[model samples]
Structure formats: C-alpha cells, structure tokens
Target chain A: MTRPGRDEDPDRLYTVTGGRSRSTTGAETFDLVTLVVSESAPVRGMQSEHAAILRICRFPTAVVELAADLGLPVSVVRILLGDLLAQGKITARHPRRAQTADALPDPDILKQVLVGLRNI
Target chain B: MTSPEISPPPAAGTGRPAAGTAQPVTGTTRPATTGGGTATGTALALLVSVVVASVATLAAVQAGDESARTAIAWGAGAAGAVLCAAVTVAAHARLTNRSLRAALAAGNARAAEREAADNHFADATVPTVVERLRNGGSAETALAEAPPVASEAQRRVLVTLAREVHKGENMRAAAMSACANAAGRVQALATSMAADLREMEHRHADEDVLADLLQLDHRNAQMGRIADSIAVLTGARSGRRWAKPIVMESILRGAMGRIGGYQRVRLHSTSEVAVAGHAAEGVMHLLAELMDNAANFSPPTSEVHVYVEEVAAGVVITVEDGGLVMGEVALRRAEQAVLGEHGDLTALSGTRLGLAVVGRLARKHGLSVSFRPSAHGGTGVLVRIPRELITEARHEERAPAPPPAAGPAPSSPRAPLGAAPGTPPPAAERTRPAADHSRPDTGPPRQAEPVGTAQHDAQGHEQAESGGYATAAPPPQQFGESGLPKRRRGQTLAAVARASATPSRTADSPHGSRSGADGRADDDRAADGRAPAASPKKRPSGARFGDFRRAVQGAGDPEETGQTPLPSASSPTRSSSLSEDDTE
Candidate 1:
C-alpha cells in the first residue's frame, strides 16, 4: 500500500483481524481488540504487524489465539492481522479488559444516629 | 548806711543781690550738665554784671541832692553793663555749645567712617576670598596678600584687585589642593574606567576568540566525519570483502550517531534495509551529507526519518525531515546539475551538494536519482539501480581489481588512450628495435606510469594554453604537490608562488590562505578560482572546468589525495601551470 498522507490523523483507532477471516460480518465481535492498540499508537498507516498481533491476541478465544493453536508462526499471523486491520473488516472493542488484577480500593461506609437526652 | 571798707561790699550785696543770686544759681545748678564750658562762662559774666550793678547803686546813693541824675546815670550804666554782660554770657554759651557739638559730631563721623570701613571689609573680604578660590587661587596666598584698606571706594577696588591677583593664586592653590584631591579621585576613576574598558575588551576578545574557536571546532568535526567516512570507504574499496559490510554498518552508525535519539526512533519506525555494493561508500557519504543538512536546518524538536527500502530494481534509500520544505524549483535545478548539466556546480555547493552527491553516486553505479516532496511534507531522494550493477559492485568489492591492470595489451594494434586523436606515432613507437624491446609490457605498472604521464600532459596543455607561469605561481603548487605524486608536483607550489609574488592582487587573497587553513578555503578557493578563469580569457570557455569537475568527482574516494585542490588552483598563474601539466 502507498504510504499514508501527511494529513492523516495519528490519534484515530483502527480495527485489527486475522487475514484469513473472510467473513466481514464478524467485525462487531472484535471491538475489544481495538482499544488495546490505542496505547503506544503508531503514526497513521505505519503500524507494523507486531502491533496488530498484540491487539488481536488480547482476547483468549480470538482469531490470533486460534492461529496460535493451529501452529502458525506468530510472525506470519501478525502480518496477516495488520493487513486485516488496515482493511477495516473487523471492529475493535470500546474498552479492552485489563490483563492484570484490579487494585482499586472500595468506598467507605458509616452510620450516625442522634439520641434525645437532657444535660445530666 | 556808711560802712567800713570791708562792710561796703556787704551792703553792696544788697544792692546787686538779684544779680549775685542769678550767678550762683546758674553756676551751681548747671555745673554737671553738658556744655559745661558754656555754663561756666555764663556764670562769670553774671558775676561781673552783679559787681557792676552794685557799684552803680552805691554811686547813685552818694550823689544825694543830684540823686535823680545820679540814679538815672547809674541806672543807665547798670543797664548797659547788664546788657553787655548778658550778651557776653549768651555769646560764650553759644560758642561753647557750638564747639562741643562740632567736636562730638567729628567724633561720630570718624566712628561712622570706621564702621563703614568694617562693613566694606566684611562685604568685600569673604566674597573676594570665595572668588579667589573660585578662580583657582589658594586661600593662603589671598590672605597673605590681603588688599590694603584705603578710601571707601578704593577699599572695594583694592580688595578686588588683590582678589584678582591673589584670587588667581589662591584659587590656584585651592584648586591645586582641590585638584590634587580631585586628581586622586580622578586617577581612581580613570583607573577604574581603564580596568572596566580592559575587562570589556578582554570579554569582547574572548567572545570573538570563542566564536572563532567554535567555528574551528565545527570545521574540525566536519573534517573528522569526512575522514571517518573516507576511512570506511577506503576499507570497503580495498580488498576486504567481509570488512565492507562492517564498514558500511559503521558508516551507517556514524551517520546515525550524528543524529539524536529522537531521529533514530523516527528512522527506525520507517522502513529500513541495508544494501551492499561498490556505491555503498558514495551512498554513505551522501547519507552523511544529507544528515548533516537535516541536523543543521531542522529544529531540535523535529525528527529526520531515514528509510532504506529494497525495490526490484535496486535499493531505494530516503531521508526525510519534517522541517523546511525546499521548493520544487530548487529541487529541479539540483537534479539537473546531478544529471550532468555541465553547469557551475559551485553554485550547487551549498545544501544541494547532498543531492548532487547522491546523483554522482548513482551515476557512478549506473543508477538513476529522483527527488520529490516526501509523504511527510519534506524533500525525499530516491536512488534506483539495476540489480546487475549491485552484483557487479559486490563482485568488485570481493576482489581488489586494479584499474590500470584491466586495460588492453601493450602489443595490441589499438592505440594507447594517452595519445592525442590524430597525432603521428612517437619515433620510439614507430622505429623501435623489436628484439630488445618486447613491447615494454604496458600491463599494470606501465599503465600506472601513464596515469602520472596523463596528469603531466594535462598540466602541460593547461600551461601552454595559458601562456607562461607567472613568478608567483609556485607556492600553492608546492603545497598541493607535496603529498601527491611527481606528476601533480607543482600543484600547491604554483599557487603559493603566485599568491606571494602578486602582493597587490586583492586584500582578500592573502587573508584567504589563513582562512583556508581553517577550512574556509573551500569557499574562498571556489570563488577565487572561478572568477579569474572565466573572466581573463575574454571568451566564455569552460576549458579547465572539466578538470575541476573530475577532481570533485574523485573527491568521493577517501584515499584520493589532493581532493580539495580548488584553493590551490584558484590562483590564475598556478591553475595555468596545473592546466599545462594536465595537457602535457
């Protein structure tokens, strides 16, 4: 593909999918994959296959995991994912689940009551 | 009423008791009063009048029967005597009072004059003293020669005169003392000012020296880079097959080292591939040149993206910066020159040299170069070459094929390239003894001999075309020839000789040498060389232009000696000698 134009925005989100997936209707299921690609964003249209593999492999049962299960070289799978990512055949998730355990603290809870009494 | 002689006067007292009483009263009552003399004189006259009055009274009484007449006579005499006595007393009193008033007035007048003198002295002395001080006279002199007090009018005049004379002396003394004090202050101030000026001068000189030193440092750095690039290229060109890739990598790393981390990251982000070939050295030089331009012109915050992509034809390497966007016209002109437009390459010696180097390198490898606005809004250069050329370059790298050894055999019918187009064969070539001379093998060593001969011929032709070498045409030739072979012997010698001989050529000529020593010679030589060559001949001929172009082209080889000969050749007389040597 030709290099991206200078006018293209670098902040825009892109959807990534495996190249072998021909079904265009499966785009909605991969929405979560698009969210993880937002960090360390590449310049528009210059993203490599490695970035796509990291994005698509976030889901355990994703096409990238399937490719891994089928014994395809992860490098080859990454290149395929980048091509699909550029074609917009898949939709990435809005917010991808965090890979590590949650560490945020819960809110505090307290009760207060007033008793009627005279100065004793 | 008849009395004794002593008692007569007592009776007479009765006769003139009033007059006697008046005399005593006046004398005693007014004795302590002012005009005492007048009072005393009045008292004496009154006493006399009293005595006269008594005598007259007694005489009138003695005349009995003629009492009336006698009384009348006595009365007249007494009255007359009284009148005379009164007039005398009054006159004496008046005279005494007038004398006393005149004496007192005189005393007061003298006192007034003295007071006036004192006042005049007061009014005149201090101001005169001040004036004397003002006029640069000392107080001691003014006081010592204090003006004499004369008449009231003369007093001021004298004080003024004394002040005029003494004031100057006093003022001088005061001023001298003041000036001595002021001189000390002035000396201090002047010393301080001098020190400040010296400090300022030192700082200014320091700044100038620092600027010069920085410029020198920058030039040294540029030379060092050029040297390192040349070393790498020489290593690659020399017969080290494995060392070529390593040298190429080193050159790439060196070029990248010139850039900061941000540029490296940006360069890595773009496509990157390394290609091997004989032109790799040229490519590295071009890369270094381009990177230098980008680093110099681009903002510190910006990144220069370098991409090395392998295409079917050859390798396409591009360096792009998101900084100043050079116009298409400039790019086109640079490209034209790169494509061998045979124009003034000196004009393209600025930033365009980077592109020109790329073009030259591409030409050396039978490649094509194209420049256009990059996808990132900056300039991009694309170099394309045939794969076969790359293979050939690789093969050349594997073997150190000597240039002189690859030519035709010495005994062949083909003429030596060194001979002129239609010239008759040399007597040695035509009538040579075959038995003794087996066509003196023109293989490699013979070919090498002709290289020097070719250069000598070139210089000789240039000299012949330009007439004779001037007296000042040897120094530069000597300098240039020092490190080079004997064929190019008179390079710097001629230049230096010409420069030293013609002292009045131009103010810029002599200074150009020192600057040349400091690396500004490149610019000076280019200008000085081009101006005289085209102007003096009257005709617009590019006679030595080809030689200059060849020299610049050969500059890419790091091991090539006398690569920068423009400074030496710029001297008209020296260049003519160089031209003569070339043509001979």
Candidate 2:
C-alpha cells in the first residue's frame, strides 16, 4: 500500500530493508495491539528509525503506536521490527484486548459526579 | 641566478644597471662613445694620409714643373691632414660604440639575474597567498609569511606582483558577488518552492496530488542544483550554508537528494568525520555531480555505490558505478573536464558541464578528485577532502541528518541565510521545530537518539544510521519516537510525554475532535481527497502538518473509505511566483 504523505520511490525503501519485502517474523505476529519493548538503547550508526524505535520503546509500546511514532507504514515498521527481533534487540508480545465498557469509569463514580454537578 | 657579478647591489629594485645608467645613455653607442681619447689616436691617421698624398704629388711631378710639383706636395699634405682628422673622428666613434654595446650587454645579463631571484621569491610567495585566500586567511598573514628578500629590486617586484594579484582577486570577487546575488535569489526561490510543495503536501490528502507534488519537488531540486552550480562556477559560495560542521554521511545524503536517480544510489560509509561548514556545501555539490554522472551513464538496472573512508589526511568518498567501461580517451576527457578549466558555461556540453562543475567545486575547497577504472569495470571516482576542511562530529551529530542540521550552536546563521532569499518562513514557522520548517529534508531528526547508551547507538545504528544517515531524513518525526524528533536527553521526557499523548490522542479521538455523524462527515471529507476540515477542535491545532503526516504516513491514507471531491487548484500565490523562476 502507498504511504499517505510520502511519495518517495520504493528504491529507498528497498535499500533500507536490504531488498526484503516480507517480515522475517511472520507479519501476522505483529498485530495492531501487540506490545513490543526495546532490549537496549540506540547505538551509534543505527538506522534512524530503529534508533527512534529503541528510544521511544524505553517503555512497552504497541505495534500500531510504533508505526505511528516512527511515521512509517505498519508493513515497513513490521519489517524493521522483524530485523530488530531477529537480532534480539527487542521483544514483542500479544496483549489481550480489554473490554470497552471496563475502560469507562464505574457507574457509582458517575452517579456521584452527577449529584455533585446538581449541587453546584 | 647567474647574476653578472658586476656591481648589482644598486640594481635590486630597478632591475636595471645602476652605475653606467647614470651616464647620458642613448640607445645607439655613437653619441655616448665620443670622449677626450680621440685626439692622440689621430697621429696614425695623419701619417697614412701623408703617405697617400706623397704618392699623389709624385704623380703630379711627372705631369708638371719642379715648382708646381713642390707646391702640389705641400697642398696635398695639407689636404691629407684634414682628411686624416675626419677619419680619426669616425674611427673614435666606432670604438666608443663598441664599448657602450659591451656595457649594455652586461646590464641585460644582470637584469636577467635579478629576474631569476624574483621568480624564486614568487615560487615561495604565490602559494602562501593562494592558500591564505582559499582558506579565508587574512592578507596580512599571507604577507607575514613571505620570506625575507635580499634586495630592494626583489621587494619592489614583490609589491608590484601583489598589487596585480589583488586586482585580479577584486575582479573575481566582484563577478562572484554579482552572480551570487542573482543565483542566491534563484536558489532561495527553489528552496522555498520545496517548502511550499511540503505545505501543499500537508494540505492535500489525495494520493495522486501528493505524488504530483513529489515530482514537482524533484524538478525544483534539480533546478536548484543548476542555480547552485552556476553560483559555484562564478566563484560564489553554494546556495545553502551550515553553521556547524556536517557529518560526512549527512553530506552524502544531502548530495544524493539532489539527483533524480537518488534511489538507485546506495551509500556505505565508514567515516564519521564531519566537514567544516564552509567546505560542506562544496563537498556536497561535488558528490551530487559525481553521483548524477554515475546514475546517468550507467545501465538503468545498475546501481551506483558510494563508499566513504576516513583517512589520516581527511575523509575520502568513492563513487563506483557498474556501467560499461569508459574508453581511454573518454576517461581522459572526463578527467580534464573535472579540472573545470573551461569556466565559460557554453564551452561544455551538458555531460562535461556536470564533471566540470564537480571539478570546480573540488578545486575551490582544496579537495582532490581522482578517477580510476572501477572493479566493476565502470568508472570509480574518489574525492579526498583535506584535514583542514574536516572536523570532528559532535557527540550528538552522529545521528543521520539528511540536510546538514545545526548542532548545539544556536546562532545557526544558515536558518536566516536559507530563508533570507526574500521572504523568511512565515512567523509561525519560526516557532515550530525551527529545523522542521528551516530545512524540510533533515534526515537525522527521527534519530534513534542514543538516548542512554553510546555503543548501543553504534551497534544498533551502524548499518542503519551509516547508510541511514546517508539517506535523506524522509520520515518526518511527526509522530516520531517521543513526539519530539528533534529533542533528546533530559528534554526527551517532554518529548516522550508529548509523543505518547500524540498517538493516544489520535487513536482515541480518531476523526479529529468532532464526534457522531459530523465525525463521519469529516472522515468522508478526508476520503473524498479534499482538504481536511480546519476546525478549532483540531487538537494538534497548528500541527496541521502533523495531522497530514499521520494521515499520509498511512495512518489515515486508506481509512477514509469512498469519499470523493471535485479536485480544485486552490493554494497560494507562491506557486505562480515559483513558476516565474523556472521560466528564467
């Protein structure tokens, strides 16, 4: 898929990934919610995107977040992450999806907030 | 010097004979030859005349009486005496002429000797002057470096040469300044065009339009190169300047970005040295020309490889292409072109012009460019930059930057210089990540910031950053790691915080700040390939470009399903102004 903002030739991307189009790790392995964390800091002469990934992943980060953070297409991010993964530079784990209702505040807390608003 | 050991001490400054010149020196020896010595020499002439007259009188005696003969002899003697006096004067003149000629010859020889000495002085002095001027060294320093001369004539000659050299320098400077003023404008226009294209890329959400903008961007970059080349040939500085040293890798990437076939060119760098700001542009341009040549001449399927090595002297860049091997004569001609001897643009065809451009740049910066038969059977061109032009990269500068980015030095004179063409980036531009707006091609911005480790940076970034740094900073740090692609270290806290907030905000509040059917409407608008709504609720308010980045980075590229709009050419006045520059 074509990246949205960028229009550079695939030639640059080809060189970046050493002409690899598929991720070494199964592409399906890195789902949107998958969480990944860097095993180390960025070293000198590391690919800027890779370094950016390591620096940003000082904390666990989701695959989608990594893609957005690096400003790369998810596919490109997967390939780079695959490279890192193969080299043991980072670890990825699938996170179970939490329910949307659980994400909202408790109903009791919501009722107290409504009563407080009425008093004001 | 083969100096005629004759009295030459006084001839130093004048380079002419001192003593005899004090005489009433005439071009011919006859006048100056005449002196008091002729009188005594007349006796021999008088004797010969008397002998001839006696013979004449003897002949007269045979034809007349004794009294007549005696009178004839006396008369003949008197006549002989007068004849002898005239002959003596003529003889004296000749002798004097001979002596003067000898003196003149001696003088000419002595002058030649002084010239040899003057040449000796020039051999030592001219290089010092040239080196000084080329390095932006002071005239006083160059003069101070001139070795002491032995004679007044030497000193005088030196002064005269200095005056002429300075005059030539002034003429060159005047011409360069004039070209610089004009080319600098064109250069600025091209640069700003790049900015405008970027801005449009921000506003437009259409894939087709963005692609078109990229092509326009490419063309603008090429035009900028031509303008910059003209400026360099005219002896003006390159279009852009960096306040701080530029990493060798970044400089290569910057050069690569200028060419149309940049993607086919791959960079392999082992050097970490940075070039001093003054020579950085020259180096970059030189590489661009070489890379362009490599890409242009080689087979379409072939790749151009660049290898950079740091040597004891400085940094060396090798551009090797896998094209057909060049003919010996063709190689020589190409090499000659690289010398840039034919300064007039029309003297060269387009191909030679490219090599000439690179040669001129290399010469100006004191970098050496050499051509060799490549291992791949194509051409291998190596450029060696001198130590003087090279500097150590700052610790932070190791991050790959596409365009030379300013380091810790805040004075970054280039910001204004790059924007100073006519209109600076709009006021708001100054407030954004100055670099983002200042130079859109900054590669290292999305740095794998060695946030906490050194070797980790090296071990992790080596392959990527080396070649990566060599790549133009294509990925904007819009939603970059830590959200602050430009900030690092202690400030990374804020960057990470901002970066974290950015992703969550965009993910949780998809479709911008609007909700319900309106959100769907905004989504429909984006899908329609129309400009996104500019509502105040756009959280990343001024970060419209950022929104475009995420959307363009494929964040929302396809998420806007089937919305379509009537594409309209509605943008800025700058587009027209930009087209005007292209016509020129």
Best by DockQ: 2
TM-score, one value per model = 0.23, 0.47
Candidate 2, residues B469-550, lDDT tens digits: the string is 2122222233446644443322234433343343343345453232222322222222222223322111112122222222
Candidate 1 on B1-584: residue-level lDDT in tens? 12123333332343243333334334444323434455455555555655666576666666645747766766656565556555554655464556455555756786788798778666876566666665556556655555556456755655566556654555445544553454344433432332233223212212334234333323433443343333322222211112222222233443443322323324432322333434444555556666666665567677677666667876566767666677979788757766864322345544345555545555656767667777766676665645553432222211221121111010011111111111112323222221122113212222333232233223322321122111113112212346542223212344233333322322255443432232222212332334443222211111122222222222122222223332233243333333333234
What are the C-alpha RMSDs, in order, of all predicted structures?
36.9, 17.6
Docking verdict class for candidate 2: incorrect
Write down the DockQ of candidate 2. Answer: 0.05
Residue A44 deviation, candidate 1, in Å?
A: 20
